[model samples]
Target: MTSSVFITGATSGFGEACARRFAREGWSLIISGRREDRLQALAKELSSQTEVLPIVLDVRDRAAVTRAVDNLPAKFDKLTALINNAGLALGADPAQNCDLDDWDTMVDTNIKGLMYCTRLLLPRLIAQGRGASILNLGSVAGQWPYPGSHVYGATKAFVEQFSLSLRCDLQGTGVRVSNIEPGLCESEFSLVRFGGDQARYDKTYAGAEALQPEDIAETIWWMINQPAHININSLEIMPVSQAWAGFSVHRKE
Candidate 1:
């Protein structure tokens, strides 16, 4: 009973971790990422362990996304699960001082991109009927607001609320939708937060145990494997050291 799983943003972070986690379970993996080389390398590595097909795609480009899905070899077309994990925070900027480019990127990839893929896959998943899962990668910042999260938080908030509506729409269908809200994870998050500023990146995690990408991957796998009758609509996973968006400790002892 092997299932097929498709993941966006498989080059790094939670998506990558999920690829490894699912591959170990004998699930065939359809990994997608913007970086061709990274995707190829990961595909090669995972193929040795399990069935894997890597695709290079930029979720922001609607045409590219469509091609990526349509070009999937028949063997990988029947995806039992799809993880919408291609996202990032371009800059930690307040609304009044936000970078327009950053805002555009957030809107395009986090909001528009997720919607595009879901729209394209909805039919495929529904056609399969029975059992299919859509896991959306979200952030706790959407729940608890922060100072410099003007656009990032808004995008995640959209994902959070959208998943709710999607779950309601797929009521009778056996399709499951999960909004995975993560608090803190140490996987180039800060670097992305500071926009490649190495100095600023060095300071975000001075003394705190942040959740790792693998942690979220494990939780996602668990939610999918739960009893068939259960639908994990939402999951809020945060590190013990992270309290909320308002407060985060950065000093040890």
Candidate 2:
């Protein structure tokens, strides 16, 4: 039987790249995103390579995720991998000045949405047994802290811890889990976080050879294709231009 994968947030960024990467290997894809036009366009583009099922979904909705999984076509009933890439950062405001709505949106999409998809799709992955895996898109913010990271960082921190704990629970089941924490990739993520400011987006990556979506997709490809017995628990990626910063110090005058 051919291998299949489910990828969320497939309209753009890592999710879209992952879809194309998997399609290269003839893996049947169930790609979901809130943008129907983009989803359908992707499905059409990949259908020539392999089977594609485009689901117009927002992972934040538990009911919608459940329905999508429960109604998977016969060919996609069993899955070899689940890519939980449907997440975002809403704002870069400091915690005290940030809007509560932004925090709630991040938690809902980054944390809760991921949870709903993972829980709903585990059984399908388990059914595939060995070689099956769950790949989550975490971020460096989760592991490190910055001035305006606030809630977005916290949500990714949850992703890292959750991925680790899941490995423990799934040890005997042959279903592996991996958390991928990336730092500063060039994508629409920054635009969203900056509320569609093109200047901010350009400045964020200008002169910085930031990692591309394809790079992360390639990393994910290597991860899920590893030997069944070898599980990659956690991996972090950062561009050459990126590195840790010294601790901040405040002096009172």
- Which is the leading candidate under lDDT? 2
TM-score of each prediction: 0.93, 0.99
Cand. 1 Cα-lDDT: 0.87
The C-alpha stretches of model 2 lying farther than 4 A from their native spots are: none
Candidate 2 residues 1-253, lDDT tens each? Answer: 9999999999999999999999999999989999999999999999999999899999989999889989998776678999999999988877899999999999999999999999999988988898899999999999999989999999999999999999988888899999999998999889999999999899989999999999999999999999999999999999999999999999899
The weakest ten consecutive residues by lDDT in model 2 span 70-79
Candidate 1 lDDT by residue in tens digits, 172-228:
878889999998788876787787888787667667788889999999999887766
lDDT of prediction 2: 0.94
How many clashes show up per model?
0, 0
Worst 10 residues of 1 by lDDT: 241-250
Residue pairs with backbone atoms closer than 3 Å in model 1 (clashes): none
